[model samples]
Target: MFLTKIDTLGNVVFSRLLGSATNAEAFSLAVDSQDNVIIAGSTTDNLGDNTRISGTDSFVTKFSARGDRIFTYQLDTVAQDKPAAIAIDADDNIILTGFSDGAINAATPSNGGRDVMLLKIDGDSGQRIDEALIGSATTERGEAVAIAEDGNILLASIDNGRAVLRKVDVNDFSNILFEQDLGQINNSGAISGLRVSGSNIFLAGSTSNSGFTGTAASIAKDFAGDTDGFVLKLTDNGSSADADFVSFVGTEAFDKINDIAVGASSVFVVGSTRGALEAGGREGPTDAFITRIDMATGAIEQVQQFGLLLTNNEATGIAFTNTGPSVLDALGLPAGTVDRIETRSVDSQTTAKAGDYFDISIDGGRKRRITLNEGDTFSDIARRINRLSFRGDVSADGSNGKLVIRANGSASVDLIAGEGSSDLLGKLGLKSQRLLGTDALFNLNDDDDQNSSSTESDLGGVFAFKLDGPLGLQDRQTAAFTLTQIQEAINTSQRAFRSLSPSILDTLGDQLGGSASGVVPTRLQSQLANYSAALSRLQSGSGGGGFFI
Candidate 1:
């Protein structure tokens, strides 16, 4: 990692390169309250210090105002980890966000693929105080992070091919202030940069404009070229109710906007373009271009292209010290912040039945009943549910067979079986606790069990079991029935059930009727009841509710 300090006039004050035996790359930088320079990146080798660990781990180093290295610490994980963005919170705590494929910490575990990881480390001592791992079934990476005036952490990420924005309350990591799916315009609508100007959020990247279908009509649908540079401005305050603007700038060329910064009334963008293009002025192939857009109109105000033809001039990052006036007034109040309610099924449902209805309650008030149409697939049902303005958005979880509902804002959402919904929640393995209006973390497997069990436990059933080997129990060859013994027997039975042949069980259920109902037959129910009574008696052991040894 290299750290260079230069005066405002572009004069180098100091230059230093710090790394390990292996390659080191710095991705993000921030300034602390005490004028210390903070850099976050990934290192392949140790820093020669005993405190540094080996492997591809994320590192945070603090340099004094005079460019003297003060403290350096590494965040080690099992797999490759990289810090993409960093910000300082209200309490001087350093907030780092990036992509991690492995465990983030002892408490935060990965949810299968690459996930967006956030950590709040103590500024004075680099000790992690709180962290969160947010991801979908697919790979999700955090590209940028900015602190809102209200102290909320605004994170910009790309999941699959869509751009995602999340507002999280730093004080309460569990509280996901809001989530917005700024649906991509093309297959290449990845997040390259993010900037916050008051209540408006500006995203810079390149898009194909081929499949750009925005959620609302207010979003402009304009494609300029094969892969034209695009800028999206969204309302940052939770009230992302509706109005958002998108602009495509290019002239039959390959253009990718790498970074954006907001000034008093202008949105400054730095990017690279190829072939002849026009924005503020004409540009030739392989050149770096800086464009200034009017914040109020979302129009290209001016563009300046540099570098000679056939020369590659790329701009990676940009920053601004001040942005005058509230950009919200010029862009109009943001529709509002949208809430993402992500859910997954504990079990898969191969088919969908008609007449399945569910009730959606928002903000602990306003209930909307949605009934499925005949022959409607999960995707079709999601489309129908999204049509309701108050319901926000509903989509299917591809990772696990489940449903995801996004509310208009961070409104409390409740999903339950409407009158004749046919155990809809139960079928989906969903419960009221998975409402997810406040929390944004969701997972399906055992890896995320520790962090999400309290909220998503009902989504996937829980079983109490004991490990093999009797550590606290003696060899009882007599009538003594210890609790551990009972637990062992229960575990054995559970394993037996898990090992049974599904086809054979289906045949037996078919012979007993209710084969497709997922309901226990009368005969099986009677047998289970008798076995339960016998187990209860065995537990009481001639006494009552007491295990005698």
Candidate 2:
């Protein structure tokens, strides 16, 4: 294990590495009144005079304020043992809560698989004072621990799949004062944060249950997605606990709380989400969020999400500093890097054909038909729209290969396609929409307009005017003039010819060519050759000739 002490300016004062021959890992740490750092973890190494019984063993190490080694205490066991949280009691006594598969001391025995373990040690002597193992017939994990105002120990644990809270008498290890199960029996949840203020106890975690209404008088919020982060406040009476409020916060995706901190007037929580949690949507597949809630009423005050859209980000820990609540997240971007979303067209179509016309009405004005001549590009479309004297500025963004229409000054930009318009709007990769004069810019591209109907109509018109036989069928004319479309048409035609009877083939050959054996007739061969040449031209970006369709 590595430990370091730093000055106020973040300069390292002293550093030390404490471990045995094998691997050692530290999970929880706490500081005493004298600034003595105490760490709790599990290790396979046999440090000091203690010997490892079997598997992994739990250990607590203390260091002085100046980074000198004070003492190390190890709890030997035959099964794996690990501490998840550490706390300092009123008299500077060390308390550790975690999970173990076997007995850590003589007083408590293993319940079954993995059981929650609570250990109390003398801060100065590094001696075990008491220990307790709490679990069911199945698995249980001790996740978080806090001290109440009345000098009692509050433990948050996962009993089976349910989150449970227990108030234990600090003097007597086996005396449990009160216990409560957090959610419904069928719902699976876990608690990662616990805080005590006055007579109220706050618990934060996540649950998969929907419509989680606490007590009838308690303030509650319904679940919003697959998994939602929750904050439950309980008024801890002398004998029992009553629910104050239970609030769920999340979007339409997975969200979970990692930690929480209570200030004088507000409760702050930090977590991660896959969807939007505030007015602005999420920035990436996953984003870290911090939410502030009213302490007296349990009303959400504000929520903010931060991260880049290109990568994942999450907040694992948070605490209240002198200024405000500080969060530790996993975004590793460089300094001064700002994250923003870019709007791009889903379909890249910059070219338009002749006879394509669409009626557009801007800012609720009179509808005007915009017609395209032969071989008009997106830039020409923008220029033509500008000449119509609209309240919006239209530009062709060549870098992103899309058209942008922004409202001029404070005037809103309304783009409406009239019922009598042609397929020109679809060809330009745009749709009828409105921008309400907001500062938020909107793109003039339609994500649903992938294959332009006008292009298909042109190809079909060409085929109907030039070809006869099966190639001249109206269905064949509807095919788009793209390589993939032409390839599919060719395959369908070949299949139809192969499935024809001998007599039908002979009739076709007599009208067009001669033989109808294994070889294709002259007329059919000529049509196939035309399609082959069209495919080559489309692949090379050269327009097809007379037989393009």
Candidate 3:
């Protein structure tokens, strides 16, 4: 990952690359009011840092105006997480939209495969303020994102081959102000661009007339050619009606729209065309055209075509400089309030024995196995589990010999024990109860109900919270243990097995071919030979051979 700075003259100022050993890419950028540039990208490794969780996680990094590194934070979910676009709100909070296999927070679990994901990050602390997972059962790709003047979020995407537009409330990411799908695209049709006007949104794309609505206008038009470019205008104020204007324009050839710009009373659509298009009088095999649509009447006002003769040409972007302050320059937000949650609770007892293990499941996350030792205390078990922390941290409740689970952000914290007959979980007083409390400051008081479990296997609970900003959670991508940690766990199991063995001979009996025919006279010599054979196999990594029988 790298952020490069250059002056208008194109002179290099500073350049820095992060995570030399991992594959990474910067997909989007935003700048705050303080001239601090924020870049969003993805990384395959833990960025060579142990503190960062592993997986194909995205990163939001900030750099000062002078080219100094401020901070880099990782954004992750249960599966591969990618940030496709980023925008800054009035409060300087960073809004990131992308796709993930699952939810990034407890409150916003993934509904299905490749769901659209939104995250709000604090500009100062590099922490998550809130989050949400929005999509259907199938795949949804969030292609573009923009912030409204009032701090609301406008997200545009193609879900299951159809265009999706949604507005998210600034205060609550999970709260959808509005959701609308323009129509499904045929094999060649696509949603190319999205832009937010004063209080309206302009969506420019292409659609086939064979099977989907080409324009939001009441009067549907037949496909003029293989595909037709379209421009749809809709109000963004949570209106449920159809788009105010939907104009489709194309001719008997391949036509595609790539971008849209909103003027005071007109909408400009830009894209490439293969054959003659009706918008422009000129008939060319390949050319780019800019069509202006009357904002009020959904009618094409003008079509301007430009291209080189005998050459293929297309216009992918257009810029009007000196019209006003650049949109990027006006992006910023004042510092917002900080919110956090800390809670402590106790287990009923501390009687977990050695060899007993139990599985844990977070808020619909994957199950993780946890084993206990005879010498393991509540504190020791808590510490061991804390090492695999996710959306929340686990610690020993010193006051009552219980577990202190704290959510670093305002999101809920849930801990569920998987089905098992582990006496350790029973002894620790695991419960099938949830933590009920507000995100606001509150302590575990007498008003709260006592959480307990009758069965040792049913440790489950949901921690609910209502907070001020987006909630960020560490993704449960894979098992938390590193290679070294797994090795340590294996070693610990071996030690425990050895310590519990009645006799060294008994422990090695299996490897010695079960006492060498059970003949007392030749047992010792035969056992030695059997042990030697097993050792050879172990050294060679052969089948059915290992240090532990």
**Structural similarity to truth (TM-score) of each candidate:** 0.55, 0.56, 0.51
Expressed as tens digits, the lDDT of each residue in 61-132 for candidate 1 is 876666555566677666778888898988778988898888766677788788888888888876778888
Q: Please write out the lDDT profile of model 2 over residues 420-477, one tens digit for every residue.
A: 2235565465777765432322222333532332232223222212123122224332
Worst 10 contiguous positions by lDDT, candidate 3: 342-351
Top lDDT hit: 2
| lDDT to native, each model | 0.65, 0.70, 0.64
Q: What 10-residue stretch in candidate 2 is worst by lDDT?
A: 342-351
User: Which residue pairs collide, candidate 2?
Assistant: 460-477
Return the candidate ranking by lDDT, descending. Answer: 2, 1, 3
Q: What is the lDDT of candidate 1?
A: 0.65
List candidate 3 stretches off by more than 4 Å: 1-20, 32-36, 47-55, 65-67, 105-107, 186-189, 209-215, 218-223, 239-242, 249-251, 276-291, 301-314, 323-549
* Number of the top TM-score candidate: 2
| lDDT score of residue 71 within candidate 2 | 66
Model 1, residue 46: C-alpha shift (Å): 2.6
Q: C-alpha displacement of 9 in model 1, angstroms?
A: 3.6
